[model samples]
Target chain A: MSETPIAAPDPPPGLSELFLAFASMSLAGFGGVLPWARRAVVEQRKWLTAEQFNEAFSFSQLLPGPNIVNFSVIFGSRLRGPAGAAVALAGLLGPPLVIVTIFAMLYTRYGDIPWLQGVLSGLAAAAAGLIIATTAKMAKPLFEKALATRSLDAAPLVALAVFFAIGILRWPLPYVLAVAAPVSIALAWFRR
Target chain B: MKGDGDILLTLAGHFALLSLFAIGGANAAVPEMHRVAVELRHWMTDRQFADLFAIAQVSPGPNVIIVTLIGYQAAGLAGALVATLAMCGPTCVFAFYMGRTWERFREARWRNAIQSGLVPISIGLIAASALILALAADRNWVAGAVTFATAAFGYWTRLNPLWMFTAAGLIGLAGYI
Candidate 1:
């Protein structure tokens, strides 16, 4: 694997530009925003390389709140500190907030229409499927890496334990993470 | 029902705490959100909660916007704004500071170990989220079929997910699913 040069030396984005970029991303994102975010940040803006984007996104996933929201904060702050984060977040969320609110109001008024209910039910099911697909795609690589490196992989096992504890057993998430995270980290340390 | 101030305060406080536990994004907190909104507070019915989640999913931007809808249902526009900010604020601050210092530990062994460990945990969280949402959405066999088909298609195909969403909606509209 070729090493990415440290700091590819891209020009820093202005606060307003950051705002516009995120605002446009939010506006265009219909089903989800992550794909659009990748297109803009990695392909269009050239702000982060594909590998860097993956690393940043993985790190963002470890943080609390929405992955994309955390991503905007980390990306913007990397460029221009706290103020940049604020602006980028505002841009990302502001337009969608207004649009979604309007949609909510419309649904409140007319949601009882039978066809709309049918449509919603279908969409909801599809949404659940999308989540499942995402989980499968993410897990595949981890499982592969685990088997590739060692005959026994603690990472995939810990993950399955977490899935069972939370998904089937219905344990409280905070407590599960509190135990699982530290244990898994230690396991990785030992394996390393 | 509670007064607006009480409701807003409750909404803000609850969502703020929820935001911190959202390790795999807002969806990870769905069961907890369901507990607080449906069972504890009676803010909305189970069906209503489900509908709001669907709306949030269909609309643009992040999944966290469901909190805005929940807050709006509970306490109007102010509640929506408060819930949105409360959900995003604390974590944003944390990410901002972490981003500044993260580069310093790029090669740290502990950091690598933590990252390796956390990947599976996060994947597990996402799987848990899918299970929760599937149980919530699949109210009947037909809906269950839609969900199963969609999952299969999404996993095996390279098609954009929006098409699945659209096709499912149309199927529902046609009263087939």
Candidate 2:
């Protein structure tokens, strides 16, 4: 790819705005933020274009931290410069700390009740749908790329198969992952 | 609880394992976390795991906040602290130290291969987790409908899913399902 200059992201509304936006999304995110993140950053705020999001998202996935954190870095760096990364990271983590502490307390007390069970069961299931929809939409273009590339790539297929076996089949997932994870790492190491 | 020691050990184990596998985000390694925490250790049930995850999402910190909670629940304050440190400690050190070097290798073929591989596997694992939740969560027609419809509706349509989440919650609240 030829080097093309990146036009700087328009200055954000402010650091506070960036903080609030990230915090709001973090607090509201129930299952995961793949959907909400895309919605907020891409569509709602128009902070980044559809194409820009696609590129950033790949990096977000590849980097070590949570994709959302990686996103905050890129998004924040774009908006606020170096300091922006700090603001975004802080905002992303602040709310969840308090919320999870309280939640942990409550969970210990009333976790096994019938109604709560029903509620969470429903939520978890819906969460599944959310993941499916999110992954499908996220990967729709990638899948198309696979077809265009005219190759049945082993990576996604193996990961998918392992997940099905472990998560769906309820196989001892650790065993499966232990086997596969290292192999993939080694494959990358050798291929490198 | 059996004691603090057991909890600390569990926390240590989870931290080590999740750190190694938690490449993308806490969620990326969740299916694996579920395996170790819920299945192998039986430290928490699937529903418990899901419940913790809910707590995790609603928290103010990273997705890994659940690790702290899980640790706390498993052991106590010490557990929580240990779990938090274990999970974040290694990753943070590595991320910082290798930051420049890793960035330099960003465009390398092996990097590309690993990433390309992670994508499909992540999708599959995520799908499998979703399917598993479907089995556990869908108990009745309305519940099942909510699950499937929410997915299809969210996917095919451009409607925000939170609205559907509320709609489903109301259905449950009404005692209809």
DockQ, in order, for the candidates? 0.68, 0.42
The residue-by-residue lDDT of candidate 1 on B90-172, one tens digit each, is 88888888776776677889888887777788888878878877887888898899899988998999887778988999988
Report the poorest 10 consecutive residues by lDDT, candidate 1 chain A: A1-10
lDDT of 2 by residue, B43-120 (tens): 777667766664564444556677778776777668777877677655544443443244446578777776755665
Report the C-alpha lDDT of model 1 over A6-73, residue by residue, as the tens digit.
24335688889999999988877776688898998889988888889888887787787888999888
Q: Which stretches of candidate 2 lie over 4 Å from their true place?
A: A1-25, A28-57, A70-90, A112-114, A142-156, A168-192, B55-62, B76-78
Worst 10 residues of 1 chain B by lDDT: B23-32
Model 1 residue A52 CA deviation (Å) reads 3.6
Docking level for model 1: medium
Clashing pairs in 1: none
If chain B of candidate 1 is superposed on the true chain B, what is its TM-score?
0.89
lDDT of 1 at A132: 86
Which ten residues in a row are the worst by lDDT in model 2 chain B? B92-101
Interface RMSD of each: 2.1, 3.9
Each prediction's whole-model lDDT (CA): 0.83, 0.65
